[model samples]
Target: MQTNNTPQNIAIIGAGASALFVSIILAKKGFHVTLFEKNPKAGKKLLATGNGKCNITNKNLSLNYFFSSNPSFIKYSIENFGYKEFLTLCEEIGLNLVTNENGKTYPASLQASSVVDVLYNEALFLGAKFSFDSKVENIDFKEKAHIISGDKTYKFDKVILATGSIAMEKLGGCSSGYELAEKFGHNIIKPSPSLVQLTSNDKEIHTLSGVKSEANVTLLVDNKPQKTLFGDLLFTNYGVSGNTILDLSREANMAILNFQKVDIVVDIFPTLDKNKLLALLEKKKKILSGKDKNSLLLSLINGKLIPFIYKKAKIDSKKYFIDNLDKKDLQALTYTLKSIKIPIDGSKGFDSAEVVAGGVNVDEVDNKTMESKKQKGLYFCGEVLDVDGACGGYNLHWAWASAFSLASNMK
Candidate 1:
């Protein structure tokens, strides 16, 4: 608490997750907090999170799920304000949180608007002021921070940049945060799309559009295996989507930005090895010898994928009968099933990305305080920093943890 008779004024530049969290905390600390949001309503991005269910945080809070230029910079904040602390904060704000079996947490009501309404109301109840539709154009740092928004200039004892990243521009994402940080002599790692769909140039793969399956996806960059994951995979006309693709998209997009050859090897039958799959195919062929060769794989895979598989395996469905399938032909089919490589052209970019992979470099920011080392009284939290997390509520957790760290330590 301040010994000064006058309450210190603090301006937060965004009304998203971190901004709201910090506003509530600062207001509780007896500081006059004001949130400047360009959107007419608060939590525009927050409301869209987790498909409107709002994954608040994850039970499995670990550094392994997050990415950054300096990965360890997030360790302090996350450790200090982990899941239990977040739950306590939520409870104090009268927000009930529930966790799924996979450890993804959401509001007990499971309505994203409920979470936003509770947080916004709590901040308002704490006497925090909001400047909706007020986009901060610039901040002049001196002994006091002067926030310029259109024709008005507001002075503050301190300013926090919670403006988020340039991902999902349609959902209120912008580059102003990076621009502000750059003006203050902060280094920014080039931003790239993460948790986004990966596009492929393979026309045949595009023909498999609307095909959904569970598969093992391996991301190969420059002909070397980078990462592998298994989950639901969806084939789209543009490219591939699903939890697996989104998970691998970070590394894939990073490689693509660097002009590296990227490909994803999708194993349609993840449960079966090549030899087992071959044996299964051979067994099917022998049992259904009288069936049309084109219909042989109907039970094994989606019917829409039959033509693609046949084309890739170099087996002519019109020429070869089920009984006439040679061992080599069966082996080729099995190989194609196990290793269907799709050449990645690019990603859907920031327009459709869930979160961006880069922002103001974390090395210049204090991990414990969320304060900029380059400029005192200027702080950062949430996705505005280079730190980002994997899908499944990790990103939102970072927002809460980083906000708590900033609010707890801000003087």
Candidate 2:
């Protein structure tokens, strides 16, 4: 704590969640807070989160939901500023929050702008200043923090790098934060696209585009099963997407980066086992005898998938009638339905990614204070650090929790 009468000036780069949050906290503590944003307005990315509803945080505040090269580094911040604390903060800020059965908490208005508005308003009301269209190109750290934005140079007592990550550049994501960290001797873990749509080279699977089914998706890396998730599985012209795919994308994208073979085995009928599915098909065959084999699966599955399934089973739908199908044919079709392998060639890249997997390595930062061990008065928060969370509001929670921890210790 400073005993001097002089007020400490703090400069925060980026007007995203963490920056806005820290600004409010520091400003309320009597520090001069200035936020430098490249965009014309704050929270451009916040407007796009949760499909514009803005998933504020998750009720289930589990460390398992977050990932980092230095995983343990996030434990202190998350555990200290859990969901309850975040909710209390929301209440204090006059934001009405609602949580669903799945634990995803959102504003009652279901508008992301509501969140941005409240945070920005509170920060401004507390005397925090905003420098819109002022992108900090670089920072020179010495006796004081010097920020370079275009032709202007501004100095401050402390600087916080909250520039976020380069996940969605269209929404103002950039490498400035990481570049600044690297200059201060902080290591950067290579970043990869996370929670993004995957791309497949299987042109045959592409034909089934626009088809969605509730099923189990198993991610196979190097011919071995790595992880499995159950939810909506959408077949796109490029590859696959949906809730399950986005959840599994981080591991898949990381594997692809490591030059490993990545594949997703989609079970169209997760509720039924192979044997039960085969029995069901046999029963359908008997009832639909003499009708085209295609008709056997008419009401059972999507019409577009009948041909695809038949092709995968190596049975000609045009030639085989229900009566012409034998027990072996039914078993083959059952197997095909149980395991529809789609090879993942790549992802939609950073532009389409919801978040990035890696960032500035956290090993050099004080997890409790979010201050750089290499540089004094320099702090990091939010996605700019190598920490990223799984889908379903975990990332946003991290942004809030990290900023909370940083602000609490700033004095």
Candidate 3:
């Protein structure tokens, strides 16, 4: 604890979640903290999170939810600063928090600005200074922290790099964070867009566009099933987007980048087995004997998607009677419904990505303290690190947890 009249000067790059939280904590700890943000305002991307509701954290935080080069890297920070601790801080700061059925925690007001406002207010009250529109072009750490922004130079005793990732460039995302880490002897994992929509070359996608179905999606890498996710899959004009697609996109994007054959297979009827579906279809054929094939499928599937399924199953759309449908037709229909493969060529890219998959490799940073192992006084936190979590407030939780860990270990 510093009892001296002069507090130690600390500089933080980027005014995102990690930087803001740490600035508040360090300022309260008697450190002179200064935040440099390239954007005119802080937390611009934060306001876009949870569709602008600002999902602050998750009650279902675990190692499984996080993805990294070292999966266990998040354990120390997350365990030290759990969800309850963050909520306690929010309550103390007069911000109301509410957790939904999915364990996603948000402000009671449900306004993202409210979350940013409270943090900004508390940090300012604790004497933390903010330098908006000051993009740090170069950083020299030979002695004390020397950060250069255009013609100006700012020096501090310690610096924290929280520039985040290259996910949402419109929200001030860039490669500067990785560039700075590389210059400081840190190896960066080739960053790619994650939690983004997957684009398919399937011609049927256009026909099925705007149609949503509760289904199970299986990600296939190199023609083999790698993982499975279940949710409402939304068919867009370009491809698929939904909770499941976003969840599987991290791995899918990586596979696509590696030039591997990536595909998404949807089980449109997840609750029904192949036999059950076949039985149901047989019964439908009998009950709707005089109806057209399209009309027979209206109650069974999305009306717009019937043509695509029929095309895949090689069933003629003009087949009006149940007597026209043979055993082979029933088999093909069942197979197509159970295993609808859509070839994923790429994603909607970083602009649409919720988060990024790669960053400064976690091995180069001490998970316990969030301090750079290569540079003693330099620290890292949040999305800038390799750690990324699934959707539903996991990434925000990591930001708070990692920032808390960094602050706890600060001198």
> Residue by residue across 332-393, what tens digits does model 2's lDDT show?
99999999999999999999999999998898999989999999999999999999998899
Q: Give the 10-residue window scoring lowest on summed lDDT in candidate 2.
A: 315-324
Model 3 residue 65 lDDT?
90
Candidates in order, TM-scores: namely 0.98, 0.98, 0.98
- Of the pair 1 and 3, which is ahead by lDDT? 1
Clashes of 2: 0
- Candidate 2 regions exceeding 4 Å error are 1-3
lDDT of 3 by residue, 1-411 (tens): 566788899999999999999998888789999999999999999888889898888988877898898988888988888888998888887989999998999999999999899999999999989999999988898778898997999888888999999998999889899999898899999888988898988877856889999999999999999999999799998989999999999999998889999999999989999999999989888888876677657878888888788889888767766668887898899999999999999999998888999999999998887889888788999999998999989999988899999987887
Q: Model 3: what TM-score?
A: 0.98
Candidate 1 per-residue lDDT, tens place, 301-404, comes to: 99999988888999866666777778888899999999999999999999999999999999999998888999988999999999999999999999999999
Top model number, lDDT: 2
What's the lDDT for residue 97 in model 3? 94
Question: For every model in order, what is the number of clashing pairs?
Answer: 0, 0, 0
Candidates sorted by lDDT, descending order? Answer: 2, 1, 3
- Model 2 clash pairs are none
Q: Model 3 residue 313 lDDT? A: 88
Evaluated at residue 317, the lDDT of candidate 2 is: 54
